[model samples]
Target chain A: MNKLDNQVIIDRLQAVLGDKVHVLGEPHGLLAIQTESAYILELLAFVKNDELLRLNYLTDITAVHYPLQEKQYAVVYHLHNLFQNIRVRVKVFIGGEQPTIPSATSVWQGANWMERETYDFFGIHFEGHPDLRRILNMDDLDVFPMRKEYPLEDPNRIDKKDFYFGR
Target chain B: MSNRITKITPNNPVFYDNDPQDELITLNLGPTHPATHGVFQNVLQIDGERIVSGVSTIGYIHRAFEKIAEHRPFYQITPLTDRLNYCSSPINNMGWHMTVEKLLDIEIPKRVQYMRVIVMELARIADHIICNGILGVDTGAFSGFLYVMQEREFIYEIFEEICGARLTTNIGRIGGFERDFNAIAFDKIREFLKRYPPVLSEFEELFVRNRIFIERTSGVAAVTPEQALDYSWSGPILRATGVDYDVRVTAPYCSYEEFEFDVPVGTNGDVYDRFMVRNEEMRQSMRIIQQALEKIEKEPKGVFHADVPEFYLPPKEQVYNNMEALIYHFKIVMGEWETPKSEVYHAVEGANGELGFYLIHDGGRTPYRLHFRRPSFINYQMFAPMSRGMLISDAIINMSSLNVIAGELDA
Candidate 1:
């Protein structure tokens, strides 16, 4: 099994995407690439369809909310090339007000539910998803609960009070 | 008589047209249904017994683990991981620990790695026992389930001897195990190894060639290799599609590279293939455990944990008598230990699939963000599409074969 070199893959991505792609330093040997929101779909398609870099397996589609950043939400995709046993992480930052990116369901069908999950949690809309509905939450619920601004614990619960714990 | 005849003659002009849509009946399988085996709901549009289409609903068991993990410190999250795949909690625990270790760049000792491998493989066997046995039960063969469940009890006894908890065993720590495997624990492990193989074989004999079992599962819910990959299936499910992409082999973690084992694969990717793959995998797991036991014997005893005083807790006696040990223990327990500011994604071949943890820390007491790449959650995505055009009974069998534990699915 010839393992695909991470550096070569990164160089190839940079060469192709030019300044639109920024190499976020490899952490734990996984090549992390930050791409402009506009080129995310193109980059995903290229990586999946590329002969040498057949990153056909979409491991996960998720988003992270960074409340203080200028582009406050990042839609992250983890892609794996099963043949070469290499994985790469692709991230696209979108503004908090209207976080949206093109859906990767077109590339990998597995992205269908994952995109819906991302939407349900962080309110990051995958623009072309066929069914963009709240997946894991109730339909009538009005909040995207995973955003950083929301408190993790229930504020109304009185059983474990701050007065007793001395917060 | 004349009036009745006249009325019948007038009503004879009526005609009717049959609408195909009227025959479709919508059935809700469960948020709580016996066949579902977990808290999952699938609304099926059926034409009598044949399913026309289906929609699945999950999150009935969702506890918002990632949200809660954002508030807890590093060491405190192991219990939460235990709840993800409760049937194979040790794997989840180890996976979480490895993620934190990767971020912190902690190189654990060889003995610690071997110990983890042993516990994780046992958990894997226990998980496969449940999946395969439940698969038999779903196929209406209850005896095989009973036979294998007894074996699972033996495995749990081993876990209890090691960690004092069976189901949600918070078995190991970030650097290594909390305590060394005592003599009794090693004896229990050896005993389990001696006791389990014949029972597993008997369980297999009950199902592998049984006509009824094979007929029910052989061709049901078949997925091609391409489809399996497109859905990002991993672990036994992906191997059942003939991919041969085991994380233990491809990206060796926990010193898996040092051991010798074969990756079992199947061609059809159906319920039967999944059953066979997992069954063979149990044998392979036993082989790995046997080798690990042998390897552990050569290493020195009583050196269970790595020498990471900052991360590992000090012994009780040391903490009680030694002033320096007491302060270190306080700092460690209070979430004040120093750690790196970095991001990492670590994956282990979990019972279901690729269980991964993506962590981002900003030199804080708690992680900035943590995402569990739950295999059950991802693998369950294909259920609806796969369930289309199958009998409701076969669909039940399909769900069992996927082994999507609700706790992991909704995590």
Candidate 2:
């Protein structure tokens, strides 16, 4: 296989995705790119099946909750092309209320549990996923715990109140 | 439906009509079956002894390490990492520190790098001993497990000499070790190296060619190369499927590229293959540690950590008389040092597989978001699918071979 770099990946993505793809810069030499949530599946498929840029290995799938931004969540995918020893970070921002994105289970079977874990913590619904449920958290949990709104401390802790602390 | 004798054949008669012949029994394999190494519940649909289907139930021990890491300061997060994949906590500890160092851009000394490789390799050997030893016990060979645990305790002694804990080490600081290796630590390592090989050889002699052990594990739960890769497997299990994708050799963190070691690959991804792969990997880890011991002697003696004063805290003795040391120590302890608003992903060849830390730091004392790409959690995803038509006994061996740590799975 030929050696593939950041520029080659960017150019290939631009040629296929046109205006849908955006380069988020290579932070720490890993090519990070962004695209709309709608085109994520197609873009992932293109890169995985592309002859030269076969980033077939999905290193990680996680989402970050950013409450201050216009788009409150950024679902990140770390994809690695094992042959060339290069990695790419794919990010797509989605709106806060009822956040949903297309699932990549059709592209990679490994996406099943990662998507479930992502849904378990951040509550980003993955459309077309085979199994989507709370993975690490109990099913009785009402709120997504990783969101900024939920405090880490328990609500029933009465002794640590401001009055008790002499505020 | 009465118990009347009816002739079905010339010499056989059927009497009772209460046979549940065509039913598939749903059995709970465990949240705590004595055979299960961890607290994972597999609800299996079995036809007699063979499993028709299975669904894994995890999160029995989930501590939300990621959620906790978001609030804790950088110096306080090492213990949180120690809980993940607890079989190799040093690897997890070093992996997290390397992630922070990648984000902060700290240059480590050669001595520190060699020291890390030695500790991490010893951790790998210890991890394999637990995994392979447990596999031996599951396969009805209990004597080998007892022999290996004795060596594993010596490794724990080495860790205890450096940092005062055995299991959840929390061994190193962010840039490097909290303190330099002592004379006793070096002696323990050298002694462990000399003492471990014979027991390892005995372990191999007991199981490698044994007929019963071979029959139980040779063809059980064999996955093809495509399936292993598609499932995002790493470490020995992936290597057992003939994929030489080791994060140590491929990505080469902690100066792993400098080591002369072999990435052992197996022909078929079966239980036996995984067992042999781990055994060979332990030997290779020993070789790497041996080389690291020799290499450390040539490097500078006193340099245990990097020269980065921002992250590495000053010595307590110097903090008393020297005002500069006092302020630096105070700043580091309180997490007051400046940091860049950078996001980076760093992976280490954990005892099991690629233990990655995806950190997004927003110039805060605590991480904005920290995600641990736990290898056991990902590698065990295909367990249910792979156990479809195997016997219940084979399933136990298969799970042991996978070495799915409960802590990492639920984290």
Candidate 3:
């Protein structure tokens, strides 16, 4: 199978989404594009089902937290074209207050757990997910631990304090 | 026959309607079950001996490695990588190092790359040995598991000779290995190469044609190619469904493209197919290791690590004797170094699947945000759906075939 060119994929995405697509250029040779949170589901479906750029594989779904940015959370989607042996990353930025985006489960069934994991860590709500819940954290935990605002270590723990170590 | 009538109170309701369709028993399969092999919980709704549906709950051992990575420097993260997939620590270590190298745009030496290939391939063989042997144990062939497990011990001895640790070996550094492989390590690897093949073949013969093993694994929890792709499956499980996507072949990190080996693929994504794929993959890993050994011998000595003074640690003797070496060592250890403000995603063909590191840096001592694309976490997503309507025994075999390590899954 002939490998699909990255430029071709970017062109196809731009043609479909128009100004809504912001091409972030290829990082480490992966075509990365950022779009609004609202267009995530539609853009993903178009990319997966497109005739020329058939990114049929959903490699991963994860989120990054940027506390200082305007849209503080970025939901990162990695899609792989198995036939072409190429991968592209898609990012959808959402506000920190109510980070909600349409779920990719409609397009790919594998997104169910990944979305739950994203929600579990970064508190990004997937609008149409069937069973969105805490995946890798305690059920009663209220804090999104992956957020930049949260301290990496527990502040209440006195075991590792400098005074205890005689510093 | 005389009829015996038992009286029941209204509250007791002894003679309630017992419809098979309505009576589904919920069984908690783990969080501490022997068959789980790790700390995983699957609440299975069973009808008779078959599972009707399953709800999986991971994170029993979640260490929050991503959050922790934000606080640790690039080199300190190697030890943490050791815990992700303890079965294949060298691969995780190499993957993390390669990600950092990608961010720094540092070119590694050819000898360093070949050494990494050798270590990563050995780790892959160790990982597959555990998976296939455990599958035998899951299917009631205990003797084959024991036989293969002994071979795994020899591999561990080689690891011990290399890094002084058996399981969680923090073996290599960011640029390259901390030191060169000694003669003892190479000898042990050679010994492993000479002894393991016949044992692996014997292990395969025990289960390949066994009627009971075939009945238990063949066509059980079979997934279509579309389903496998949709679930983001990678590694042997993904290849079992006839998808020819391998990170090593596609991306070719650590000089894997130079090695000649075939990606073992299977048509049916069933337990049997997964078993066959992993079994064949072990042989392929051995083939890679043999080629790597021959190549490593041809390379010059004492070129284990790259010449990155800022990142790579100096030798202890140099640190003690030289002032500049001492300062550099202190700076690197104290996390007082600068990094480029960039983001890169690097993946390696991990034992379980595509273990990727998506690192975002802001020129800080630590990463701004780091994400581990754990393949076990992604591949294990299909477990609940695949378990639906399968026999309880078959679900156990299916779980073994998935090879979901709790450390990697919960990380």
Candidate 4:
């Protein structure tokens, strides 16, 4: 294997991913690679099994909500290849109203629950999961609590007017 | 006989069917099953004693730790890590604070960092003992379990000497340990080292060569090194598959780079290999403890904490005498310290696996987002592949070998 520098690796990845890679500066030491929903699984598959860059382990899968952005949710995949012993972060952006990303279960079976959990907390749907249901949340839950726009009610501000209304 | 037969006449129709040659049954192994150390449930589709398929049902112990962390102040989360993976509380505490410190770029003193390494390794041994001993018991080697527990008791005593509690030891703060290592605790660890071997040997005697134990575990949950890596298996699970990857050696956090220890790797990724790896790890942990003891004995007067007192709480003596000290202490206690806005991920090689904390701080006392890459939770993904087609008893042993702490899994 060629011993490539970190920049060379990044440049090579950019060459392969073209305009899909969006290097966000806010999250330090992270390369937020943005891709379309349809290409989610393809990018993951290439990362995991690609000869040049074999990122076999899916370290973590999570979703972050940016309420201000045109794409309100970004599903992130942290991948690591034991052979190369390097980790790469992949992010796919999805619109808030109907957030969805292709499932990477076929590429890495470990993504099964992590994707489900991302869905459970942030309501980001995985297009091809075998069972895409509420994981940590109750079945009756109506809201994705982790969303940036999710309403958070103040516990101390409860109105006593409701208590006296029927009285 | 004819009169008895007549008296026992069939009162109901026989459902108009012939008996099936074979029958398959679905068994729900509880959210309270004795086999599951904590509250865990497994819905098993079985054909006689052989399990066809099984689905693990977790979340019975979920405390919504992530949600709770959002509301609590920074220091308060130290005690919460104690609850996440209760078996290895020190590691959890260390991992959490390390992530926060990484975000803040706090530089702890070498002595304090070394102390963290020693205590964390000790906690890892205690955790592995619980896991390996429980696996032994599940395989019907009860004596091995008893012996391991006895050794664990000694480790627990040292923990009690340091902290008021044993099980949930909220030992470390953000910058360093809550208190300096006492002489008594150090003495207790030395005594434990002497007595620990015979106990581990006794367990090895009872199970290592026992044909039944070996047969039950050896190939029951055989996963290749590649498969283990693919599933993000860590600690014993990853090592059992012949991967010499210990995060202490690989990443070296908390000054683990200073320690001289071997990363034990096994030939096969099976339950037996996991057992062997954990046993060898116990030995390695003893080596680390011995080295730490020698170092501490030589230099007992070294400072126990870092220079960053603003990040860490100041001593009570200084707090009362000095106004600046009082304000810094107050700021730390109130979790109002102006921690720089940043995100960092800290990975520590915990007893079970790679325990990582992905902390995102939005220039606040509390973290904006905190995610735990819990080993138990990820390792449990391999259980289905490991247990399918194995006997029900083998499945139980395999599950035990995986060491899926329900608290960590559900958290």
lDDT (Cα, tens digit) per residue for candidate 1, span B256-364 = 9999999999998999999999999999999999999999988887778878888889989999999989998999999888888888889999998999898989999
Q: A1-167 in candidate 1: lDDT tens per residue?
A: 34578988887887887888889878778989899888998999999998878888898888889888999998889998877778999988899577889998888898998999999999988889999998888888888999988887788989897788888
By TM-score, the better pick of 3 and 4 is 3
Find the candidate with the highest TM-score and give its number.
Answer: 2
RMSD of each: 4.2, 3.5, 3.3, 4.0
TM-score between candidate 3 and the true structure: 0.95
Clashing pairs in 2: none
- lDDT: which is higher, 3 or 4? 3
**Tens digit of per-residue lDDT, candidate 2, span A1-167:** 56788999998888888999999998899899999999999999999999979999988899999999999999999999988799999999998579999999999899999999999999999999998988889999999999978888897999888999789
Better of 2 and 3 by DockQ: 2
Model 4: which docking level applies?
A: acceptable
* Candidate numbers, best TM-score first, in rank order: 2, 3, 1, 4
Off by over 4 Å in 3: A1-3, A162-167, B1-22
Error of 4 at B378 (Å): 0.8
Q: Is the docking of candidate 3 incorrect, acceptable, medium or high quality?
A: medium
Instruction: Give a tens-digit lDDT track for model 4, residues A1-167.
Output: 87633465567667887765655543545444567777777778776667777767788888777787898887777876566556667777789577877888888778888887888889988888988887666768899877755545545775755876785
Using all chains and alpha carbons, the TM-scores for the candidates as numbered come to 0.95, 0.96, 0.95, 0.92
Candidate 2 docking band: high
Highest DockQ: give the candidate number: 2
For each candidate, report its DockQ versus the true two-chain complex: 0.77, 0.83, 0.79, 0.46
How well does candidate 2 reproduce the true complex, by DockQ? 0.83
